[model samples]
Every structure is written in structure tokens, then in C-alpha cells.
Target: MDVQEKCRSWTADHLRDSGDCYYQAVTRTSGGTEVEFRGTWVIMAASHDYLGLSADPRVREAAVAAVRRFGTSLGGSRAACGSLDLHEELEGRLARFLGHEAAAVLPSGFQANLMLAPLLADGSYVFSDSSNHASLNEVIRLGDAKERTFLHGDLTHLEELLASVGEDSGKLILTDGIFSVDGDLCNLPDMMKLADSCGAHVVVDSSHDLGVLGPNGAGASDHFGLRPLLVTSALSKSLASVGGVIAGPADIIYYLRFHARTSLFTAAASPANVAAALAALDILQSEPERRVRVLDLAEQLHNGLRALGYDTGSSVTPIVPVLIRGRERCLRMWRELCRAGVFTTPMTYPAVRAGREVLRVTLTAAHTDEQLMRVLDAFEAVGRNEAEHPR
Candidate 1:
């Protein structure tokens, strides 16, 4: 079938059956731990707000103050007139926090990843992790470079791909610190060694790990005591704000700021978002306990679910993937969870391979032990029902 016809048919069938799992409107939120999802108050496990600072008073105040001072937007791209003091300030703080010489902020994480496309000069080679986020994949597709994809976290496969390429070719290895769908970490220590052996630069998309990993929330690279050639991340995650950052050496950041069409053409991030991110950064640093608390909670949940006979699939991070195997089965599980007063996300085709669907449940520092117990109870109830029905 043609694209339009296929879309029409799929939308009608999918929405009719499982659309509530896709976009249930959240009318209100309390920190990032709970939300009024579709008029029902539920414990939130579907958010990327790992630090639970989105509803923090300080972050809210910072954003509100910026709006009052800057009047919503600067109204142009940073290449022109949209640049603000807040943008430069946030960039500087991010670079210092990430142990980089410099950083550049973008409107979103997708655009931040796209910023790498312009850096792929002729004869450049890119070795990418197969499970990297779609934005990273798109960057490879947009650039005029030879591409080699290695199986997720498979160092041997990565080594083979790197060996096949000419040593002198300008090479950049792209990977996600935490695979979004699978919730497994990249083998950065081994991968970095491989890249160094081949004289290839490495770039890590640490969108999901920043502020939730490492000694000081600098992300996976920091956790491994190594730094990539560059690190790209979304402030929308652990930072509890809206924007993206690319952190690296001063020269490379300067080059991307000037030449990256994605950043040059798009409007700069709003002052409010920049301010909110700055506030979040402060919280991430000052309140390191949030990281510890959230991680502890994640481990608790992961173990609980496993003990209950769920397939969690190699996850070692706050982002947990409960493999449900079938699309309709996954949707039904999501619906059942919601009914039990727990909010979660369901993943199906395109997000994951067909029939290997899952529930993408995330944990935040604000989540309480009682709430966690409730989540496990909900899962147990749902699992019991599934066993009885045998779907």
C-alpha cells in the first residue's frame, strides 16, 4: 500500500485499540513523580524527568523570571539576534560540569545531534551504534560520509567495522550512553579504547544519563573516567528543562556554532528554558543525593519486577524496559497499569522491533518507597490477570 493509505489504515486501527497509551493528556503534575493523567491522579513512571525538578519551585521561578525579563523569546536564531546572556551562561556552566572546554546550546536534542552532520567533511567515516537514537542515525544519513554500524554494545563487531575502514580517514564513532529503548548502557570503556586504537574520535549522546549517572551527574563518560570527543544531551531529561547541548573543545564548538545549518537556521532556545536549565544544573550539582536516591529506587524496582517474572532485558539504568513481546499485549498491560493508578509508557513497532514490544517505565528521585511498592503491586495484579486470560 502507498504511504498515505497505509498511514490511514494503521491510525484507524491502532488508535481505536490503544491510543490512550500513546497520548493521554496530563492536566497537572506534582514534581515529576506523579501526574493527573487524563483526569486521574497516578504515580508517574513515564517521564524522562529523572531528577523530578520540572515542578520544583526554584526552576519554576527561574523560568518565570526569564519570561518577565526577556518577554518569551528573542525572536530570531542565535546566528542573527536570538542569542541571550542566559544561553551563553548555560553553555559555559554545562562545559565546566561536563569537563569540556566549551559547549553550545540548541533548541532541542534532535537539532543538537543534527549539529554533527555539518562536521562530516568529505572522506569522513562514521561508525555508529545500531541502537543509537534516531537523531544520531539521521545525522549519519544526512552527511556525506561512509557509515559502519556496529551491533549494540558489541565491541568485537565494532572492532571489525573500525578495522575495515582506512586508518587515515577522518572517523567519528557515534553512540548513546544509554540505549533509549533497551535501557542498557553502551560499552563506552571498551568502545573508547577501540576508537583510540583506530585514531577515531568518539561522540556520545548522553541525553538519558546526564544528571542521573556519574560521580557528579556528568553522564556515562564521566562514570567511566573518560571523555568522548564530544557529548550531546537534552536538558529536558535530568536537567528538568527544555534545550540541548553539545559539549566539547572550544574549537569544535565554535566551528559547529558557525557552520551547523541546523543551529544556524533554527531559532535559539528561549530564555526561560535556558534559565530553567541553569537552575536545574544548580540543583543537580548541589543535591547529589537525588542521583543516589533515584538510582537506588531504580534498582529496587528492577529487582522487584524481575522477581515477579517480568523480562527486563539487560537494563542497568533508571530507564527500565519490561519486554511484553506482543503489541496488543503491551497496550493491554499499559491500560491495566493505568487502571491500577500507575502511569507508564508502551512501546511497539518502529520504537522496537515488531513483537518485541515493551513498557518504557522510568524512575525519578522524587518517587517514594510507598509509590514504588504500589507500582509493583499493580504489575503483580496485571500479571496475574494476564496469566488467567493467557493472551
Candidate 2:
């Protein structure tokens, strides 16, 4: 069948099922841990707002002020007149925050990853994690560099790949600091050792790790007290804003600013987003407790689920995946949780492997202990019913 036929088949199957839980229209939100879906208030457990500052008064005010002063978009790419003082300021602060010499702001995290292609010299060897984010894979493909994949977190496999490459060829090791699907952290310390031995430059896509990892929330690289050659991330997650950043050495950032086609071609991030990102960064630095609380909440939820006989894969980060055996079962569980007033994400085929289906549960700093208990209780009730019915 053609692509359209395949699409129609999937839609028909999903639309006919009571378990279809995709594309929930969130009509309202408390801007924190609760959201109103179809006029019902549900505890949000699928959000990426790790710091829970997306709706913070400070961030909102900063965004509103920017809209008033700048009146929405800059109307062009950064290469033109789109560059704003807010963008420059945010980049400066982010560079210091990430322990980088300099940083470049992009319209999105996807675009930040796109900067990779422009940096790759010819004959570059890209060693990527099998489970790296799609954006990283896209960047490598765009660069048209020779690519090698290693099993996720399998340093021995990576070592073999690195050893096979000639010493003279440029080597780039690309991996996500936190695997978005399974919520497992990359073996950064061991990976770095391998890279160092092979004289390969490491690039960490830290979209899920920034503002959620490290001693100062600088990400996994910071947590390990190691500096990769470059780091890229989205501000939309923990920073609680919209935009992306590429942080690295000043000279390299300068090169990407002028050479990276993605940044130069796409419209610059809106003034409000940049302003809100700045405000969020301030909050992130001042309130380190958000990081602590969010991780604690994640651990609580993970342990709570495991205690109830659910398999939460190896995740110490805010993103937790509750492993389920089948796609239909995962969707049914998600629907049950939604009915119980706890909103979560269901990951099935295409998003995850067939047997690796899961209910992707995430937590934010704003989530309370009471809310967490409600979530666990909801899961417990759902699991009990499923056991009795065997659906």
C-alpha cells in the first residue's frame, strides 16, 4: 500500500477504538501540574517542563513585556536584522551556565542540532548511539558523513568502531545526554574516555538534560565534570521557554553563526520567547531546589510504579517510561489513566519499538506529593482492573 493508504488504515483502527488517547486537546492548564482536557482537570504527567516555570509569573511577565516592546517576531533570520539584544544576552548567560566559551541561539532545538552539518569537515566519521534522538540522526545525514552506530550505552561496541577508524580521519561522537524514548542517560563518563583515546570530538544533544542534570543543572556533561566539544539543547523543556541553543568554544560558535545554514535561513526566535527564556534562566539559577524536587518526584513515581509491579526502565531523570508489553495494552492503560484524571503519554509503534511500548510519564518541579499519590493511586486502580479483566 501507498503511504496514504497506510495512514488511513492506522487512523481507521485508532478512531474505532475506545483506547485512542492521542492528540488530547488541552483546552486549559493551571500552567503547572494540572491541565483541563475536555473540561476535566487532570494532573499532567507527560509534560517536559521539568522546572515547572513555563507559567511562572516572572517568565510570563518577561514575555509580555517583550511582546509589548518588540511586537512579536523580528520578521527575519538572525543573519539579517533578526538578531535581538535579548538573544545575545541569553546566549551569554547560557554559555556561562553550560560552562562553554560561547553560545549561539537558534529558533529551535531541532535547528540547533542542524548546526552539526556545517561543522563537519569532509571525511568525518560520525559515531552515533543507536538510540540517539532523530534530530541528531538528521544532522549526521545532512552532513553526509560516514556514520557508525553502537548499541545504546555499549562502550565496548563504541570502542570497536572508534578503533577501526584511521587516526587521521576526523571523528565525531554524537549522542543524546538522555535518551528521549527510554529515559536512560548516556554513559557520558565512559563515552568520553573512549572519545579521548580515539581523539574524537564529542557532541551531546542535551535537550532533556539541561536544567535537569548536573551540580548546577548544566546537563550530563556538567554532572560528569566533563566538557564535550559542543552541546545543543531546547529552551522549551527545563528552561520553560521556546528556542534552542548551541554552546561551544567561541571560535566554533562564530563559525556556526556565519556558516550554519539552518540558523541563517530560518526566522529568528520571537522576542517574547527569547525574553521568557532569559527570565527562566534566571529562575533556574536562583531556584536550584526545582531541580532537586523534580528528580525526587521522578524517583518517587518510578519507585511507586515498580512497587505496584510496573517496570520503569533505567531512568533516574525526570522522564520515566513504564514498560508495557503490547501497543494496544499501552493505549488502554493511557486511556484508563486519563479517565482517572491523570494525563500521560502513551508510546507505541513508530515512537518506540514493537515490544518496547510504554506509557511515558514525566514529572515537573511543580508536581506536589499529593498529586503524585493521586497518580500512583490511579495507576494502581487501572492495573487492578486490567488484571481482573485481562484485556
lDDT (0 to 1) per candidate: 0.91, 0.90
* 136-243 per-residue lDDT for model 2 (tens digits): 888888886798999988989999999998998999999999889889999888888888989998999999999999999999999899999999999999988888
Error of 1 at 27 (Å): 1.6
TM-score of candidate 1 on Cα atoms, chains taken together: 0.97
The backbone clash count of each candidate, in order, is 0, 0
TM-scores for the candidates = 0.97, 0.96
The TM-score that candidate 2 achieves is 0.96
Please give the range of 10 consecutive residues that has the lowest summed lDDT in model 1: 17-26
lDDT of 1 by residue, 1-391 (tens): 9999999999998789876777668898876788897778999998889988998999999999999999888889998999888888999999999999999999999999999998787798898888899999999888989898988888899899888888788999999998899889888888888888999999999999998889989999889999899999988998888889999999999999888999999998998999999999999999999999989989999999999999899998999999998988998889999989999889898888898899988878888899999999999999999999996
Q: How close to the true structure is residue 4 of candidate 1, measured as C-alpha lDDT?
A: 100
Q: Give the runs in model 1 whose Cα sits over 4 Å from its true position.
A: 1-6
The lowest-lDDT stretch of 10 consecutive residues in candidate 2 is: 16-25
